[model samples]
Target chain A: MTTTSARAAAADVVIRTAGLIKDYRSARRGRTTGHVRALDGLDLEVRRGEVFGFLGPNGAGKSTTIRILLDQLRPTAGYAEVLGATPAAGGPAVRARIGYLPGELAMQGRETAGDLLEHLVRLRGGRGSGRIGPLAERFGLDLTKPIRSLSKGNKQKVGVIQAFLHAPELLILDEPTSGLDPLLQQEFLAMVREATADGATVFMSSHVLSEVEIIAERVAIVREGRIVDLDDVATLRHHAGQQVALRFADPIRADEFAEIPGVEDVEVTDHTVRCLLRGEPDALLKAAAAHHVVRWVAEDRELEDLFLDFYRVPAGELHAEAEEVVVHGR
Target chain B: MAVDTAARTPTPAPADRNGARADGTRLPVARWVLREQRRSLTLWAISLAAITAMYLAFYPSMATDEMEAVMAGLPEALMSGMGWDRIATGSGYLESTIYGLLAPALLLVFGIAAGARLLAGHEEDGSLELEGTAPVSRRQLLLERFAALTFGLFVLCAALGVATLVLAPALGMEVTSGNILAATLGLWLFVLAMATVSFAVGAATGRRALALGVGAGLAVFAYMADTIGEMMAGGDWLSTISPFGWYLGGDPLTQGVDGAGYALLAGLVVVALLAGLLRFERRDLGV
Candidate 1:
């Protein structure tokens, strides 16, 4: 089935964080300093057997949501439920059923990858050999080297393997592909697909919506600690599509094109007219052909334009932040 | 050929056990603790062996006539500090004074250090989160670590007992191997008590240095209280407040496991363990 049908078909809710808010006081000042509102009154849900993409701007509470859901960080207010139990109220029972890759992966320096894998499996109540070796092989992880000696990307590969080794019912990953290259990112997506194929729910948090666009059935866009948009991937795209510019064969007045369906902000400049279109292109084409029989160029709408329109931020300012998002998605 | 077809995947049945997804057994708790303690095992073995070997090497040399005469000529203050006041005078006294008091002190420090490392040190190194999210209760985790430390202490005590048993005959000492075994086991129980106390401190304050500092400071204070209570004569009741005093008064080297002292030490250990569990249950794991 398609993702939309799959979402409608499955009634299971694997994870939900309701009215979650987290506040962190500044470390340097003793007084309740640096009240970092990491998560702010956010509610989220991930249905079973689908990849849910959690997207947000920098410091926009994507990680905060994941952390609180995993019971790694306590919420200043509100509560979270993972796998049908309150996370803050002893979520270990729920945590055991889920696989989590932290946004920041720091492991024991002296331990080799093999040793860490062996130890983590035993800790998570599974046999060490059940999935470690195969997952490592798939990810091209060198399990022989000490963790301290491994590169950042190598360590991230180990983190990925460990999280997926147990084959959890719910996989909660925070920037799980942070250090992976393009090929590995695809492989990781394939792994997620396989897990979802086995009736698992994958909650992938990343700043780049494009990374999510490939695998996510649904995308939740978070901004400044609140979810600004929550919808299926196709709907979000439809709602945020950029305008289509249409040029006429002859000198047409800007006002003439304005009356055409789905055309907005028409400007006629020396036999060329630029306009934004939301719906079908046939109407604009018909309108242009009636004016004259000549050549025209209809510039394709960029996805970035749609992104800016929906986010309400200027394109140039978001470019730097988008680079960081790409870095996070790796 | 044109084809219009689809594959329908069957839906899985709902999980039979509604409240169960992961195993709720406590076995993982023990496994996690044992795996974490692998590094500490080698260090603990070497250190405890060194402390025992240091005593074994030096004790036999003091068994000679000239050395015995020198010990007999030692000042009362030195003897008092060295725990020479309670037991009979002999090479056994020297052995007991060394192993009975100092060895337990060293073991207490070592065992308690290991206990302190279980939480506070793991938290400091950022690996606490690995096990913190495991399907284990905080109390279960704490008890598992204490069990590992207690197991390690038992190994240390057994090794010490065997070493003393083999060496006692060569030294021409008349002490029974049974007495030495009992004394060693008793000393281990006392150190276990100290370890339980340290575990409580570690869980209560999620800071390694602070836990160790507080544990060591508490030991020193107990030693002082025991010393002052003993010297003052009328204030012997004050010794009840310190676990060190309770175990130290047993004089296992010569007296060989007095019932009251054994009871006191056992009570102290049980109380400490229960307090540690309660504290662990109430506190958050990675705080």
Candidate 2:
């Protein structure tokens, strides 16, 4: 289903990083102490107009990576480029085409939201006034209230507005929906959709899968500064296996169900049989029909298990497992 | 304080957002920096006016012979040590106390506080992320912010100049407007030196306490080097390098423009700002 237009669009890499490394040096009493590696040879390629999700737990170098792309933090070693220009060498001209939302936003002033936005718009030297009204109205943001008086959600809305104000070619948002309520999260998602429709690329990072799973075409799960898992949402859905339990009218051979394709971890106690069903369940279901079916129950397997497979393993072992997953995924 | 951003457009932006074609766009970052500081600047200006008026208004009373004898009766070493040499004459009284001592000292505190807060405080509080990622370059951000700091300090120092000119005649201080300008200009430049020092430290370190400590510490050391060091044998050279020495030692009140004072003090301000910019750009921010 890849149209020529889609193929052409997918060829452009909006952001690229290779062998990127960032190490933070700690100090005690002015003495040099050991350092923590925030990023270890991380690589990424985000296609144009794609909603790429950067997933990681806290202290996983998610923020560190975003900051490096924005040239806010220089990498200890390696390279990063945005829109064909090295982020550090891109200068302001390159950044002018980018919009960023910091994860830990700090807006302190007596200025009202309107005042802050106006100042921000002026700072970018853009005609952002056009986007301000609709974005604010859509988010149900009160523009006249002083920024300090606004609630956390309201402050986050302001951050959202400023990020989209200029309609930059690329948007780098770090936990953009942190304080939004569920309903507002929907509105934020819709806004992101419209932004992408207009040919803008979105690179959003989140620790949770709910939002990212909905919008992202591809996602990279980072752990301890390296990408442990990466896959497409479509592939992710296919991997969403379910745990199935069936109670037969009489005792039957549970070993038979275990032998079937796409069924795993079968266990039986007298009349009931339990197993995991991955992909199509037709074969497993048909096999169960031969026996009396008294009751059947199934629950979707937790996605956390997929992440646990990566997160719990030691780094050296995870590398081989991660490569295997990637190889089998495609 | 909003300079038409047009007038201050930074060194022709290498290129506009669209391409290599540069445009004559205004400098909004500089204006934003100034706007952010307006409230603090207002408070500092108000305090400066009140203190300057209160101290200058009492100059007439302190100019009396009785007050002069009282100042003299105090230990000569203590009086001379604090630079309170001539209270009988209006010029001497103004120079030794208000113009020379209190105004510069208070201005130093204001400058250092603002300097520390300018970059380092915002960086620590995590507020610098907004401007840091804005389409503006670090050079523009640094210079524009420093411009705001420079503008804020300059305005307060200029107020001291104007207030003294207005009060000198009413208080019967035997000093011309030109003399007040000369003396206040020295103080103003001296304050700029210290403010830039603090600002440079903050920009380079991204630590408010370090910036504040280093700035305030330098002010104390410079004050000592200029005032107390003179008493020590072979210590006369200390004032030559100290900003306080550049202002007070030259006695700009009596000696019209201290060309050397203006040059050296202004040189220090420029050097600090450029050095800060170079360091700030080279180092990792938000550390």
lDDT of 1 by residue, B1-287 (tens): 00101111222223542123244334655555666566766566666666665666665555567765666777765566556543344335534555656666767777778778877777667666666665655666777777777787787777667766776666555677767776776777777777767776787657788778777777777777777666664767767676656666666656777677768767876787787677666544453
Q: State the lDDT of candidate 2 residue by residue for A135-203, as single tens digits.
A: 777788989998889998999999988988777789999998999999889887877787787788999
Per-residue accuracy of model 2 over B98-173 as CA lDDT, tens digit each: 8777888899998898888889998998878888898788988888888888888888978777888898888888
Model 2 chain B poorest ten-residue lDDT run: B1-10
Docking band of candidate 1: incorrect
The lDDT per prediction is: 0.68, 0.82
Candidate 1 per-residue C-alpha lDDT over A98-161 given as tens digits, one digit per residue, 9 for 90 to 100: 7788777777756689887776776665433346666777778888998889888888898788
What DockQ class does candidate 2 belong to? acceptable
Error of 2 at A98 (Å): 1.3
Give model 2's clash tally.
0
Best by TM-score: 2
Q: Fnat for model 1?
A: 0.35
TM-score of each: 0.76, 0.90
Top-DockQ candidate index: 2
